[model samples]
Target chain A: MREEADVVVIGGGVTGCGIAYNLAKKGLTDVIVLERQVPCVGASGRCGGGIRQQFTTDANITLAMESVRLFEQLSVELDTDIEYEQGGYLIIAYEDEVDQFKRNVRLQNSLGLESRFITPEEAREIVPLLNIDPIAGATFCQTDGHANPFRVVHGYARKAQKMGVEISKFTAVTGIVVEDGQIRAVKTDKGTIKTNTVVNAAGAYSRDIASMVGVSLPNKPYRHEILVTEPVEHVLDPMVISFKTGVYFSQQKHGPIIGGIGDPEEPSSYNISASLRFMKRMARTVVELVPAFGHLNVLRQWAGLYDVTPDAQPVLGWTEGVDQFCQANGYSGHGFMIAPKVTELIAELIVDGKPSMPIDDLNLKRFEGEITGEAYVVG
Target chain B: MTEIVCRCEDITEEDILDAIDQGYTTLEEIKRVLRCGMGPCQGRTCIPLITRIVARKTGKSLAEVSRPTTRPPLQPLPLSVFAGEEE
Candidate 1:
């Protein structure tokens, strides 16, 4: 815990670690990451780990596609096997959504992605046991996949540490010292670190950190629960996502079928408690999709927060009033998948004062008026 | 039969001690290393005992040794709850 640093990042989730790792690797000096809890102990660790580019919104598709490209080489670069499975993402559309699904697939194709629309039977060909009777069609993106959230977080943390970046865990940031409208220091539970730059990569806690500096982020934390079944013989290959049921699942290489469902009734709060409702709904939906997974014993069920914004997109770039305060929050549920690219671009923005990636459309001001194009969120 | 500290994860007192000996002093670290309270029950059954073990081993007061971060669903709920009857 130093008394001063060049930059103080306020979170230990994959976002913070990834930012720290990229900053340090990019030759930034005196960078320190302050984590209130252990690394990967937040939403970054609790997610379904699905990385996909099959999104209705261009912002999400671009971010996710770039993330997938980075993930393809992350294991070797970080020297840690992230257990990345590029098996593909299979999105099953119910009869009612076939038209909209085709439009999304067309958009994805125009964006240079290799994704395509396929018949439900074609989806069955990919997953073998999919219940295609009720599904009208599906979209397959071979580049989309899943990775180990734990390993990715740790890998970034370890690499950041190796690059002389100090990551102080169990140290909570209590306040932000903004003197004359510029970041002066970061006050933490452990100690205060004087710095000019502060990155709020706080995930669900981003709002709290932003409030410390009087910046209002429109992101709220919503609870999302997930469960893992006892490892069975590998049955599913691509991740099976359904828009109708709001459920998505994938069998990991080591065997457990891991997944979750989104509850529209879930309120915005800090609650991470698992709910019986989510488990049952997810189970029933899973069974309804693939009857063979009906009786698979659930090994564990847990909940995590999703930092959702008004348009279900992320709020990136520097704040309006704050000179050196940058935000990388409001990722909704896709933070882990887009972390590598997000953090890389953030580092570029912080270090070079401008990001090469086009992120002006993702600024915090988008929610000030009528937002456009609601992001297509699925299971 | 020997006593069990964490039933859901099948973690015993000895496993906790061995984890501490291996230098995983904190509850979260030990939990990660030994899967002590990371089962379906999510540490409700074993956290107190592990907290005591960690305190005793580290010679710190209960308050001095931090409890593992309590993540949500505080209790495991059935999948049926989220799956409504309309289905």
Candidate 2:
């Protein structure tokens, strides 16, 4: 491992790798990415891979819209087949959520996202097997979809390495050497890398990394479970999600139906063990939504953590007391969906001293006062 | 003659080596990149074969290569089973 670098990014997941790739693309090649395990070994590899732009918050909607544009060209830009499918995302609404969804659709349409609130019958037209009896209304965004999270991480890491960025796997960050409120070096199990700038893109462990610099972050990790069924005929295209039950599912390009459900009772922790209760709840919810899924065999079940903040939004930009210590974690559960644009903006912030987009609304300082939480977060 | 390692994903020995050459040296890394152990069988048939290949190529002992994590339902089961419906 190199003893020195211009910048040292703390994780090698999609967020970290994406940031590294973007940094290198912008002429910052003397960078190193440290991963506790192999790339995509965290939430980046375990997510349901659904990318959507139908968020209730303007920050999330604008970020996802720009990310969708980047994802449309990511496969060609990274020189890898990321299996990106832009079939669209359908968010079903229950009786109580109808008004909220109407306002969300209006806000989304105002932001130039071609999202429209449709009837239950229209939703069934999009998803033929959907049980729309409980759906009061639905919103559809044709530009939102899913992709292979593993391939996305692989493409970013490979391209970043080819561009002369070093990626060190199995290297755990132990501490951060800070003097006079400026980052001087990063201590790891292998050796310390002398660097002036550090980006905390550590995903679920971002809070822990922040603590190393004596900066307290409010982000906490929450476990979410997902399952995939055996590869079958491609019946479903767009990802169908329900705001009422927090159950979502989509068919991969190769045919497996992958989905997940959120357990409201889940406590905040780093625990990612798959549970029988989650499996049962997910099975019941999915079958209740689409009875045809009961016939498919579940191949595997796994879990990943969502680095959640109080507002369910990501904390970006530089830290308050620590100079040159960039904060880029806390995506809640939608990191992969917005990674392309988020990483690009973060790179611009680090290299050009400013980002084109106005991200002051997403900084850690927002937590000091009253914040409006995002309402469209799904499992 | 080419040797097929993962029948579920139709992955050949050459495919595994290519993924390893691309810096995906571990069992889990190769599985994500190539889908060797992620098919219907869930690595039942291919895990052992791929482990040996990875050990030989990376000069690591069989015990040195970390085993693939075994997740639930051991075998494929209908969603109805978990949903509390009779098969």
Candidate 3:
């Protein structure tokens, strides 16, 4: 490993690799990505890979829309098949969430998204397997879908490597050296590297990395669990989600049904151990939503951490006191969906000193006062 | 003649070696990239075979090559069984 570098990215997930690739594409090739384990070993590899624009926040919807566009052409640009499928996302609403669904669909439409409100009967028409007895209504966005997260990270990492970005696997960052409120170097388990800029793209460990430079971030890690069933003939097209039950499920391109549910009672911790509780709860919820799923055999189950914030939004831009220490984490649970656009904007911010898109509202300083939390975050 | 290590995913010994050559040395990393051990068997038969190949290729002992993580329901079971429904 070289003893010096221009910029050192702290994580090797899609966000870190994507940022590295975009930066190198913009002629900043002297970058090094440090991964604790292999690439996509974190939340990126563990997520359900559901990409949707049906969000309650403007920043999320805007970022998701652009990310979808980028994902459409990502396979061609990266010279790899990311398995991007725009099969659409269906968010079923219960009686209590019908009004919120209306408002969300209207806002999404006004923002140029093709999202619209559909009745429960229409939802069943789209997904005949859906048990719509408990559904009051739903919102559907045809442009939203799922992709292979592993292939995406692999594509970005491979392209970044081809563009002369060094990716160091099995390397863990120990500390960040800040001198007079400016980044000076990064100390890893392998050795220390002298650098002027650092991107804290560490997913669940972003808060830990920020604290190395004495910057306090309010991000906490919450354990989220997911499971997949044995592959069968393709049946489910759209990803089915419900805000009330906190359950989301979609059929993968390979034929298996993958999904998860959020436990409101889950505490903040790094514990990623899969639980019997989650499996039971997920089984009950999914079977009730779609009875056909009850006959499908569950193949495997796993868990990953969601680096959560108080407002359920990512902390982008630079930190208040730490100069050259860019914040690119705190994505809660939707990091994989918004990584393409978020990393592109972050790269623009680093190279051009300003992003083409407006991200002033997503800075780290917004947590001081009252903030409106995002309402559409699923498990 | 080509030798298939992971029959579930139809992956061969050459494919596993190629993935290892591309810097994916770990079992989990190779599994994610090649989908060798991710099939219905869940790495039951292929894990041992791939372990030996990885060990021989990377010059590590079989013990040194970490095993793939084993998850629940050792066999594939329907969701109705877990949901407490009469199937």
Candidate 4:
């Protein structure tokens, strides 16, 4: 299936649709998205769906604030119902880390985010059933929220197509054609697509996709597991997080309690099976956090891979000596939430001949161990 | 009754023991030969049952039974829903 297009985007996850949406909206209409399997078969649909602006880095914090604003108005902006609930974010602190929470809240407030340290009593006021004794302090942000991930990708893909972008699902890219140090075309299972400009948004598999062009991406897959409870009434209004335990949960509109925890030994893979240890550990944390969830049965649990870079920040710039090759891959775990601005940045980098933001600091070259500092508050 | 364990693939504890007795060592190999948990719903409903069966049959810990493969449509919808108009 040999074809020609103005741009060929690889990987149909959130970032892929994001880049396509922005490019189509920016007037580069001849775009084709080649997906390996169905869309959202990757990390996009499998994420925690928590959108927050709390970050240790200035760039991520600014991008997240901008992203939260977009998510707040995304339904009207995209002309589709995204079910974006502006529930607040609660980060619980225990042990000696209570001081850390206070310092983070102070820094966050100084950065213009509506975050502050509160007493354990205030924490329980937000979530009545939460265990407040062992908890020393908490950071509350009123702007952070959660959304349905499937709707986000579907929304962008729909809007991208409405703006004239072609997304071909089940199209696995096997090779990238480069000639004279420039990307010429992309070879996929369906056929070869002749295009000078190509964007790599392959999520966890970004390293493999970039390797086809002889570029070694530092991105690697890490397993993140999540679980859901049987439908319960709307009791929890805010998205709760425990910095001590890697647990976060939100009561969805459908009434099911959805959330996940970070695993220390989560190996890299596309594997999505839930583990017994994770269930037991997650159950323990869930019961400790919200005692009311103890009686509710776990309907299902699942796992997905996160594309983790060395610094955990996304690599979002063109490679040296590789012309016409733009990359927006390796968000580590924050890809889904920041995708809108990331896509717009990548599209502007392509069409406007430069990025609308100061994205030069995000190139792959910054992760050579020289820039070790990055955001720490990830759930 | 030992019970019919995996309803999605109609696998039972007796069938699992039979596969292990036939020298099927790994879970993947046993699943390949017996079709233990393969179906439209994938392994969501059948996995815990298979894990329990394998742990009971092999006299191993529950954690040693190994995790099953999870495919896409984490919730399976019709391909048609993804088809038709791009918008």
Q: B3-73, model 1: which lDDT tens digit per residue?
A: 79998667888888887875567887677556676666677789998899889998999999888766544
lDDT tens digits by residue: candidate 4, A1-379: 3398989999888899888988998899899998886667688877878887777677788778888877887787777777788788888878687777777777777879988888999989998988897788788888888887777887788789889898887689999889999778889888899999989888888888888888999888888888766566889988888766778899876577878888776777777676766666777777767776777656567788888887878899788778988888888788888887888889999999898788988898886658765546454
**lDDT tens digits, residues B18-86, model 4?**
877754544654554454544444666666877776777779998887775564345643222322123
Interface RMSD of each: 4.1, 1.1, 1.2, 17.1
TM-score, cand. 1 = 0.88
DockQ of candidate 2, scored on C-alphas against the true complex (2 decimals): 0.79
Evaluated at residue A19, the lDDT of candidate 4 is 89
Give the TM-score of each candidate.
0.88, 0.99, 0.98, 0.81
lDDT of 1 by residue, A32-92 (tens): 9998978778998888889988998888888889898899999999998898988899988
Model 1: residues with Cα > 4 Å off, grouped in runs: B1-25, B30-87
Candidate 3, chain A: TM-score against the reference: 0.99
- Ranked by DockQ from best down, the candidates are 2, 3, 1, 4
Candidate achieving higher TM-score, 1 or 3: 3
DockQ for model 4 equals 0.02
Provide the lDDT at A297 for model 4.
57
TM-score of the second chain for every model: 0.83, 0.93, 0.92, 0.79
- The most accurate candidate by DockQ is 2
- The per-residue C-alpha lDDT of model 4 at residue A162 equals 87
